[model samples]
Target: MRLKNCLFIGCLSLMSLPALAETVNNLFQVREPVSGQTPDEKTRATQAALETLVTRLTGDAKAAQGATLAEVRKDPQQIISQYGYDAGPPESLQVDFDPASTERALRQAGLALWGSNRPVIMAWWLNDATDGANLVGDGQSSAEPLRRAAQHRGLPLRLPLADLGEQSIGNAKTLDGTDVAPLKQASERYGPDAILAVHAQENGSQWQGKWHLWLGDKMEQGSASGASAAELADAVLLSVSQRLAPRFVVKPGASSSMALEVQGMTLERYAQLVRLLEPFGGRLRSVNGDRVVFDVSGSVDQLRSQLSLARLQEVPAGEVGAAPVDAGQTPAVEAKPGSTNVSLPAGTADQTLHLRW
Candidate 1:
C-alpha cells in the first residue's frame, strides 16, 4: 500500500504544470464579474474616466461634478448649461481625448456622452489625465501635457504672448525694463469686469489651486481645487460664467492679455500667443506674475505697425516675428513699472483686484 501511494505521488509530480499556467488560470477565473457589475461597474468606471477626459479636453474642473454619469450621457449640454461652462466647440474638446478613453467611454458610459459629432485632437494632457491611475497626480510640474491641453482648447483663460513668454523658465524669475511692461499694461487695459486667474502653489502634501471668478476686484464665483490645468480651466469657465451672468455681460469688447504660469513653456509660447494677439494690434511684453511689476501703453494700430516693421508679414504665420510697429499708428498708452501681486477683493468690486485660482 505504501509503495502504491509513492507511485501515485510520483505520477502526480510527473504531470507538473508551470506556475505561470496557474497564474493565467487565476486571471481567467471569472467570478460572475461581481454580480451586476456589467452595467453599474461600467457606469462608475466611465464616470471616473470621463472626469479626467473632460478636464483634459476642456480644462474644466467641474465636469462630472456638475452632472452625474446619467446626466452627462443624456445631454452634455444640460451639464454644460446647468454648470454654466463653455468648452468652445465639441471638436476642440474631442481633440483632447485619448483613443482608449473614447473607446472605454463608448463601452461603458453609453453613446450619449461618448458619441458626439466632434473631432478629437489626441492631446497628451487628455491622454494622461484619462488614465485613471494617474488622476491623483500633480500636473503643475509637467509641460508638454499642459501645453497641448491649452492648445486643444482645454484651457479657458487665454494668456498673452508676453505673459506666456514669462512663464517658460527654469525658475520664478522676474522681468524688467521696457521689454516687460506691455504685458502688464494689457491686464490693466482689460475693461472693468470679472476674470479668472489660475494660481498654482506647492503645499508640501499637494498643490493648492482654485478656479475663482472675479467681479471687478472681488471674487464672485466659487472655488475648486485638486484639479489638473485643464480641469482648472473648465472650472474657471463654469464658475466665471455662472457668476458673470449675475455680475457681468458678454459684450464684444477689448481685452488686454491673460496671464498664466505653469513651471515651463510660458516664455517659449509667449511669442506665439503674442502673435495671436498682434493681429488685433496686441503686443507681448514682460509679464512675470511675481515681483517686477510694470505698466505699458500702446494701441491696436501701433502694435500692428510694429509687427509690419518687424517684417512679421514675411515671417511664417503662428510665430512672433521681430518687427516694429509704425510709430505713427502706435497708441499713446504708456507702460508703467511696479510690483507684481496676487490679491482678490473682499466683497465689492470698487477698488479690489480679485485673483481667480
Candidate 2:
C-alpha cells in the first residue's frame, strides 16, 4: 500500500522551532462575531471565544460545560491574555489566552491536551448534485463546508486539484471502492498523513455521505446522513476527530530521562532537534558534542513512538559503536555518570537516531 512513505507536510516542517513555538503559543485563540464595542458585547464575545477555545483544545464539544469552564468564567481575564476587534460592518472580537494557564486549567479538570502539531488530511470529495456528478477541489464552493468543519475542529485539510492526474482515477465509482491506490497517487503532492474519500449525494432536503478514512495501513469506512450539507460536514468531522483524538492526545506518564546520540549533526540540525523535542515538555540536561541528554516526562518507548511519527530514523545496534572523532573536537558519546540506560528490542532501539537532512 506504499503507506510508509506517506509523510505529511507539517511533520516535515517540525524542524523549525521558532515557527512551531509561535503556533503553540497562539493555539488557544478564537474569534467571535460582535455587534458593538459595548462592555456587555465584549464580555459575551469573550465568553463565546473561550467556549470555542476549550472545545478546540480538548476535541470535545461538551468540554465547555465542565467544572474548569465554571472556574474560567469566574474571572475570564485570569486566563485571557489579550483581546482586539476586527474591522468590519459587523465587527468581530478576537481573544488570545495564556497557553500555560489554559493548559493547566485543562489538566486540573482532567482533560486531554491535543498538541498544536496536528496532522494534515487530504480529502477527496465527490458530490452527486442535481445537475451531475462532479469532483470537489481547492477553491470550489462545494468544499467550503468541509473547510469550515476542519477549521472548527482544528484539523488541516487539503482538497484535491482534480487535474488530469487526479481526474484520471478520481471518479465517483472508483472512490466508492476500497482500493486506495488512486487516492494515494493523487495525494502525493499534498503529502497528507491521512486521506479521506467522501462520496456525498443529495436527495430532496436530505444529504447522505459515505466516507472512507485511510490512516497508515489502517482503513475505516462509515456513512452519515444529515438534513443539510453543513450538518453532514459536521458529522464527518465528528467521526474523524473521534478516531484521531487518541493518537494526538497527550497522556500523563511517569517521568524518565534518556541520552540521545546523533551522528553528523551540525549546529543548525542540533537546534532543530531541540525545537522538535520542545512539544514533549522535556528539559535539556546537557549537550556533550554530538550527544544530547534530556530529562523528559514520559516513558522511553512512548518518546520513541512520538519521534518515529516525526520521521526520526532509529540507528540499528550493529552500527551503534563510537564514531571517529576529530582531533581536538569533543565527540558526542555516552551518557553522563549515574545516568540510567534504557533497553529495547534489536529493531526498536531508541537511544540513537540518524539525522537525515
Residue-by-residue lDDT tens digits, candidate 2, 78-103: 88889999874337898888989988
Query: When superposed on Cα atoms, how far off is each prediction in RMSD?
Result: 26.2, 8.6
Each model's lDDT comes to: 0.28, 0.64
lDDT: worst 10-residue window of model 1: 20-29
- Alpha carbon RMSD to native, model 1: 26.2
| TM-score of every model versus the real structure | 0.26, 0.69
Indicate which candidate wins on TM-score.
2
* lDDT for residue 41 in candidate 1, whole number 0-100: 50
TM-score of 1: 0.26
On the 0 to 100 scale, the lDDT of residue 83 in model 1 is 14
Q: Kindly report which residue stretches of model 2 are placed more than 4 angstroms away from their true locations once superposed.
A: 1-26, 31-51, 73-78, 81-95, 253-275, 284-295, 299-305, 313-357
